[model samples]
Target: MRWMKVMMALACLGVVSACSVVTGGPLVRPGEPTGVLEIANGSSHTLTVILIADCSGMSYGLNRLPSGSTIPPGRSYRFTTSAGCWDVSAGLAYGTTIYETRFTTQVRPGRLTRHTVTGR
Candidate 1:
């Protein structure tokens, strides 16, 4: 009976550990340096929406750009975040145009990671 109880406790511990994966644990642990993510607009269209997701997330959290703002062609925007890999998407003003060139780039500590979106 004791052995069976031990096994059950171990099984519960395993399940709890597995829950971290589904819970979206921290991408950058405490005390880690952050970096800059530069989204450069090489495409002719103005960018009205920019969303970024940490690799651990199920979906993009929110639009990083400020409300009523836009990034015109040849311009760029930067975000300061924990140094790690991220997925990025940028779209046009009407939300009808999403650049197919999705970004899965690595950001180094205290460095700049640039992902440029060009024409189709």
Candidate 2:
């Protein structure tokens, strides 16, 4: 029956869909400016931004910035995204101990989260 097929499709979608429940009612809410997270790399080596969201089961995990994508030295990447988890942690992997930073507060709507990686 068509209804049966529709139900199955929705079930599959639900199994793959991931949502985040943030406190303070989400920064952006229903109608508001979306938040952005920007990262600047001043180190000599390329860097990658890895995000661990509260719950991410979608394709390629819940990474806002996928892996393999490199941010060359002296480059910056701005992620204009929204929150889908109650808590999110962002880390800058510079392929060395020279510099590293992790920000646990992330994906907040209506706000711009910024992180700069520099040599220690």
Candidate 3:
């Protein structure tokens, strides 16, 4: 009788545990409608750094280009990001000279946003 009762209790406990809601996977959700950003180096300098910040003024946290990578003059680089408003900053390689500083642009999903950097 005691063994039967223990088994019943175990079964009841299992049923109770199964009744509780259980969820798994990513704890945080991602932004919707990702888009692309195309930066064209229309200047005489090699494009080195690309910084992106959201409309809320929060930066995307780092340079969009990989280390040691650069877009030569007349070339362009594309970046995939969430669709929304952004602030773009582009500078010359190995110097403090910036051709485009905090240039605001809109990125739409399923669309390409093209921005050209001049030698200003």
Best by lDDT: 1
TM-score of 1: 0.69
RMSD of 3: 12.4
**Model 3 — which ten-residue stretch has the worst lDDT?**
20-29
Q: Could you give candidate 3's per-residue lDDT for residues 50-106 as a string of tens digits?
A: 877665643434566888899999999998877888778787753764555458898
lDDT of each: 0.77, 0.54, 0.72
TM-score of each: 0.69, 0.50, 0.67
lDDT score for residue 111 of model 2: 68
Kindly report which residue stretches of model 1 are placed more than 4 angstroms away from their true locations once superposed.
1-30, 94-100
Q: Can you give the lDDT of residue 55 in candidate 2?
A: 41
Score candidate 2 by TM-score against the native: 0.50
Encode model 1's per-residue lDDT on 35-115: one tens digit a residue: 999999888788877877778677665667888878899999998878988888787643564654567889999999988
